[model samples]
Target: MNGADAQSPVIVVGAGLAGLTCALDLVRAGLPVRVLEAADEVGGRVRTDRRDGFLLDRGFQVFNTSYPQVKRRIELPRLRLRPFTPGVLIHTAEGGRIRFTDPTRRPSDALALLTGKQDGKPGTGPGPLALAALGPLCALDLLAPPRLLKRLPELTTREELARWRVPDRVVDGFLRPFLAGVFLEDDLDTSSRMFHLTWRSMLRGTLTLPADGMGAVPRQLAEGLPPGCVERASPVAALSAAGVTFADGSAADARAVVVATDAAAARSLVPGLPAVATRTVTTYHHAATRSPLREPTLLLDARRRILNTCVLTEVAPTYSADGRALISTSVLGTDAPGREAALREVLAELYATGTRDWERVGTTTVAGALPAMVPPWPLSRTGRTASGVYVCGDHRATGSVQGAMASGTRTARELLADLRRP
Candidate 1:
């Protein structure tokens, strides 16, 4: 590298996936870089905490292998990801447990969910016709090109489902609750494009978690960078021509500054950035004596009492402490009066076990769990800012693991091209 390049390293604010990725790309391209993080560790919103030998992610999240960016950026085997059952179990208000399996993923289990005859029960499910319709819908989303999906008229997810003629029973009993957890909104107002892309990834990918925790994702990314590149506990205050001002009254000079925080933080850090509305979600972790239902598949409340619940330890034994099962349940908003009590009550009904003895390990409430995507949305962006600074995150593009890393990659290339322009 030139003497000038050596002196002025690129400064990256926020050591989340996007920031870590941007720094890694630039470092690999022979540029000196520094990453500043407000928090003590990486992963931003995608973080995990350890309590009593249990791994509690900030919220319920899974690593999707089918996300193009995930496959390209993350080393799957290194994570030792464990997949959930390719389906979900719905606990109806009527006290019946219904299973919905994705036939495309496991054809052998097709007969169960496809015909609505699980465990020799005829009327326990949504019926053959309605459930059968799902495969084609998922297949369409799985195979359709992004360009083609973008060309379609903009619509809310509810509208798109109506256009496809999905049965009300299937939607209300299953999709509605399932998607509430996915989009973090109960109304299904998320963009059809975003919904389709999310659904496509779910259909084509294995829903799994890293054995360590979600935080391990960003940790792996940060590890790839040169030592001392990421400076933790370093909060960036402002971006200036000389580079960045830290919250502690310190400053760092740089050739360029990139903001890679979450949507809210990014907007606060970079003035006049495009506004991205977001949704809130909270996850509660509880410890139980044994696994509930003996499967790692998500169990949804048909009554919508809780977004979804699962035995985390069933998916990964190491997530538990003292050989107890770890159960996690999420709801659509921040805390409220009697919310924890309500969560426990619903957990008992859903799991058919008394939660009186289960211990509440941790509760994580995320203000902006996901950006509210409404059409006409740009699935991807250039990460260019009007203030002459660079910005990248899930908020800049579609909200997902893919968007964060892809935005980081895009911003790095943009910065590299600018540096090369004589």
Candidate 2:
């Protein structure tokens, strides 16, 4: 088994976004690579289904134009990005609505949005911090690793919002709702490192989605790979410097291997990967007889508990077949059995709809849907890199499609560099 023989072929495990993207990029760079997917298909967390002529995503998810890695790596035309309206309507238990908008794209304005209040007004009002955070949000090119690392251990999200004089009530009501939708946490319980980075990105990019569904992004990458590059449903049970073996007893000799699955799965596949924390989210997809509103998307900020109602139809009109709306209430930390009841109570309080109106078109409860993305985020959770092994996934970065891609690319790049070393 020499360098040109079967002994040293590069093997990438887990055909999720990161794995697929990493494998594709490496092959494009003139390196030979093979991808193994545990499931019958690719796109691990990004599962999309076409139901009765309507596209339904497995869980509630969305992306923004500001994702630097995704923008650089993905072909935009293939996925078709749809922008989210600038404003998000907040529906309350009293059947009252308050709409929040950012007036500036600069940091100061973004900072201002932090402190502004609802003033008992519904729609068309600027919160305090919305104005101050403008510059920071719009300047994400300046907000990457080095720049962000400077503000750590001190300039936290809570601290930054407080510095802008964001009113307590508004932070509880407005900022919390926005953050919850993004981080999938109720309060600002997530780490400041993650929140600050996210805030900067949101300020830089506009919210966008694919016309097909979230899965389309992963699907496009998978299709671009060489025909034999991917082997579906071949779960690798173990790996060594000499070769790899699958659950069915088939094996392939490889000089290098990369594990790009979820954190939990990675721990089992690799020898010394750390444990990854988990969080839960419940997504309620109801086809309202009427529309949730004429608007396609709204972000509701209730008390510190339930986060927001994401109106999917507003972002992409094709989600609903009969013009019936698809309103997804995304609740984090909510269990499967209790999610339906919780959503009903919240919706009835917010939209004035009774149990009768929310006719339950569909519901999905994703436990560990999103890894508990708090600070001290386990960067080393990806398995230990021994003689011929590497690791990559959203867990290796932030829990996002782009994060996954970036990690995978990093792994492949590292492996290639190692192979070329003298």
Candidate 3:
């Protein structure tokens, strides 16, 4: 290494959002930093693919505007974000559809509830009066600031919901599938703290997709950094307190090292690290001549065959070209044989249309999509593994994009503070 190169720049492993965020913060502090990524591009799990004129995200993902870290780091207007309708459509087990909309966004729907006009809807889900009554309580409980949520005793999400007086019908019909999709689990065993935070985020801002794709998020972060700071397709074979060794038998010296890869990779680098369970998710994309559901609303399956599905083209027309519609479906855990056929059958029933003509585009399975947030989960953990060695990722905190960025920022601040100490 040259004299300048050997001068101890902070080395960051993996060019995902967490690593990129840390690098950007370090750069802003006028500190020299280097990022190594195994993939050819940044964004790790957050990627986009263009196939047959369809922009398919690596997995079914959504960008929330309410994440404080996102607001601080991202230029929202540049993304040209397209939003899903502020509510969801539930396909009931009885083969009926129920529409649950945010009263704040669609006052007409609220008015319909007040006038008892919603009773005419297909599914015998929660009645309008019941839904309207719960809205205020939900807003007060979930939309409260983070400090308030932190004060509450930690509990599993299912237990927390049990404490609430929400009707069983509402929980089973809507909240179950909806929260399952978010937590990537059907049992609602995630941390109640995470549940409240996620609920607050959703209530505070819209769920959106960039005009380009989810990959645009990481691209934006990477673009803001100094050129050549991120070295793609350079995988680190092992790590130590001093620096890292590359797969090519090369080594780099650094004052500090941050392992910002996924949970599995981070554990590999630092043995005996606390284990964080992860959830798996599989997303299937298909093309249709016309949209099965014309609205840009997420549809949840009450039967739990499919966690959640959305018409991506309806939410953002750029996802598809030539008037073709793109439908994205997500299922929890690994897919089994005949899963595609079973999913298609479920889709046909849910949309009340035939799926035989829908062209299957592709399927992407992420085994470690999000770290499982169980009770007693800490909002933030000390990123330091040892002197000069640290780690951060979704596993170190909550399991959302917001959590990932926040953890990265925390690592950056901690590293800077430690480095400045006398």
Best by lDDT: 3
lDDT of 1 by residue, 158-255 (tens): 99898989998888988998998888887888888888888988877899989998899999999999989999999888776678888878877887
Model 3 spans > 4 angstroms off: 1-6, 111-121
Q: Give TM-scores for every candidate, taking all chains together and pairing residue i with residue i.
A: 0.95, 0.85, 0.95
RMSD of 3: 2.4
Candidate 2 C-alpha lDDT tens digits along 1-422? 12335335578888888898788878887777889888887888887777755677767877677777778877887777777766566654344456556555434333323433244444433444444444453354244663554356644456656765666656655677777777777646666666666666666667777988888888888888888889898899877546678988878877677788877787787776667787777676776766655665566855644656766777887777777667777777655666587667767666655645655666666666666666556432332365347888888877766577778877777777766777
Order the candidates by TM-score, highest first. 1, 3, 2
Superposing all C-alpha atoms, what RMSD in Å does each candidate have to the true structure? 2.2, 4.1, 2.4
lDDT of 1 at 232: 91
Candidate 1 achieves a global lDDT of 0.85
Question: What is the full ranking by lDDT, best candidate first?
Answer: 3, 1, 2
TM-score of candidate 2 against the unseen true structure: 0.85
